[model samples]
Target: MSLTDNKSAGEELLLSRHSVRKYEPGVTIPEAELNEILELAASAPSSWNLQHWRFLVVTEQANKEKLLPIAYNQQQVVDASVVVIVLGDLQANEVAPKVYESATPQIRDMMLGQINGAYSNNPGLARDEAIRNGSLAAMQLMLAARAKGYDTVPMGGYNQAALIQELNIPDRYVPIMMLPIGKAQAPARATERLPLEDQVIRERF
Candidate 1:
């Protein structure tokens, strides 16, 4: 299917909302499609343009098997066409000088100053900022997958320590979420949400 469709913006947004747990058997997500979806995900905004999220796509059966137990034995981890392990680099600014150098000079110097200042004054804040940037990227990935007619489940419940060990993720990187993607087994039922009036507060709060 072509990425560009004639659907109105609102229609696209509404239709793109669904979480799929079950998937059809023996279907593999095309590598091209996966790449396109991730390309779109990278466009998500981040503080100081610091893209701190790293996605590890688990495709091999053996690697997936190693993750199954760590993921709470969720069948989706093993059965889905793709499993995206979202890792947040807590010290990307310090570790990747090239990432900053690639940025435009205006933003680059600004971010570098902020990074250096915070690292010296408040290390905790620097760590918090990195995780925040990474989370924004993860959300973009999920929404981009949805927009492309793919179904996904965002998994947060799992054994973090075991997953880190099994995946060989470094100490500076934290596994924040796992996303299993594939076609849905059945159409998703309508999800209940809080009323807009209750959920959105005006400026007065």
Candidate 2:
């Protein structure tokens, strides 16, 4: 059944969540469906709309084979339907004049001045902030995938340096993580979660 057609309570996105490792062999996700999910991922908010996230969708079998070794030899690296490599550009925000120019005049002036102030105050801090912002977008993509009845695994076991070199990513770009997407061979069991009272804090501690 299509996720869109299922309006049943048991099919709620959150309730249907699971981390899939093994997937059915020879299954491929359609391009349109993949784009639809990515569109939702792109809708995730970012600082000043800079949208620092960059995704590399891996489908070529040869490329996947090369990545397998670098990804800690995880069989899933080559087994999944698709592997999306999430990247963060560390220098995009520092070069934001055109970004401001694309904005409405009022916002353009405001953002230009704000960006200047941010740069002057702490150049390095802004880059780190941008990386963190990109990470949030990556999380949004994973959630959107799960919501669409797709199984995913967020992996950081890969060698970042090797991936960056293999992907020919620019020096200012950093690989954040890899997300494997497809149907789950078996449903993932729920893991432990911290109790609300233990994790929550009131207005004043």
Local distance difference test, per candidate? 0.78, 0.79
Please write out the lDDT profile of model 2 over residues 1-205, one tens digit for every residue: 7546857764576556656777665678899988988888888887777777888899777888889989988877787788899888776666577767777888888887886677578858656855787788788787788877788888889998899889898887778888888888776666766888999998979
Q: What is candidate 2's local distance difference test score? A: 0.79
TM-score of each: 0.85, 0.85
For model 2, where is the 10-residue window of minimal lDDT? 9-18
Top model number, TM-score: 1
Candidate 2 clashes between residue pairs 3 or more apart in a chain or in different chains: none
lDDT score at residue 162, model 1, on the 0-100 scale: 87
Q: How far out, in Å, is residue 178 in model 2? A: 0.6
Candidate 1 deviant stretches above 4 angstroms: 1-7, 102-110
